[model samples]
Every structure is written in structure tokens, then in C-alpha cells.
Target: MNIQNFSVASLLAVITLSGSPLFAKEQTQAPAYEYGMPLDIAQAVRIDEPKSTVCEVGQATMTYVDTHGQIRHVTFLQQTDACAIQ
Candidate 1:
């Protein structure tokens, strides 16, 4: 009945409506690929092999589609003395 009480009630109603799911924002999905582990060798499309000083140090690149159907590039590196001549 009081003016002050009526104002407080209106403010509370506004806050509640704003917090409801109908007014909430949508969320985006995360990408399927990230750094760290190597991608599946079978799915990769060999792209390039940059020059290296020796056979022991080799580097190659490839591309493939992730589970999300997004294209991704990956680099492979090898560093070992196995290729060195005795």
C-alpha cells in the first residue's frame, strides 16, 4: 500500500526477470583441436618438409580435419642420432 514498499517490490521483479533463462545469453561450443598430442597419422595430409642440417633432425608438416570438421595443421619433428653414420 505504501509508496516505498511498492518501489522495492517493482525493483525485485525486474531483477528476477533479468536473471531468468528467457533473458539469458547463449553459450558457444569449444573447438575440437588443441595443442599437445599428435594428430592421427592416418587422417593427415602430408603438406611439407622443411630443410634440416642432417637426417637426424627432420621436420614435416601435414593438415587434417578435426572431429568438429575444422581444418587443422600439425608439425612433426624428429631429433635422433639414429640416422648418423658410424
Candidate 2:
């Protein structure tokens, strides 16, 4: 009936239809990988399920999903030299 009431009603309707919280509308995204790691790591590392992956730069371990949908873990470099392979 009034301007204040109408504003609130309009905002509620928009939020309800969107099915997401108002805070979500201006959501901030997290870093692709854990902190204290080189920026290149995020770009080079691959993960099947980014959300499920557990990246520990200090431990040099990265978890991801395989092609078969199975979870897998890999290290940056173990015995074999990755650069040599390339």
C-alpha cells in the first residue's frame, strides 16, 4: 500500500523467484586452489570435480576425479620428471 511496503514486496518476489538468497546475487568466488601456492598451479592443475578436489600445495598433493568418475590423487612431481616427459 505504501512506498516502503511496495519496495519490500517487490524485493521479496524477485528473491523468491530466483530461488537464491539475496547475498548470492552478489556472491564472491573462492580461489581456484588453496592459498600459498604459485598462481600457475591453479591454471596447470586439472580436476574432474573442482569443488571436491583437495589441493595441498605444502604437501604437494592434489585430489581429483578420473575419467571413470573415480576419485584420484596425484603429486606435482614424484619419481619421474614431468618436464622430461614433455
Q: Estimate candidate 1's RMSD in Å.
A: 12.6
Model 1 TM: 0.36
lDDT (10s digit) by residue, model 1, range 5-81: 99999999998988886444322222233457646444654556555445565655557666667556665665534
Work out the TM-score per prediction. 0.36, 0.23
In model 1, residue pairs whose N, Cα or C atoms come closer than 3 Å (at least 3 residues apart or on different chains), thus clashing, are none
* Superposed model 1: Cα runs more than 4 Å off: 1-42, 79-86
lDDT of each: 0.59, 0.47
Poorly placed runs, candidate 2 (over 4 Å): 20-86
* Top candidate by lDDT: 1
Clashing pairs in 2: none
Shift in Å, residue 19, candidate 2:
0.4
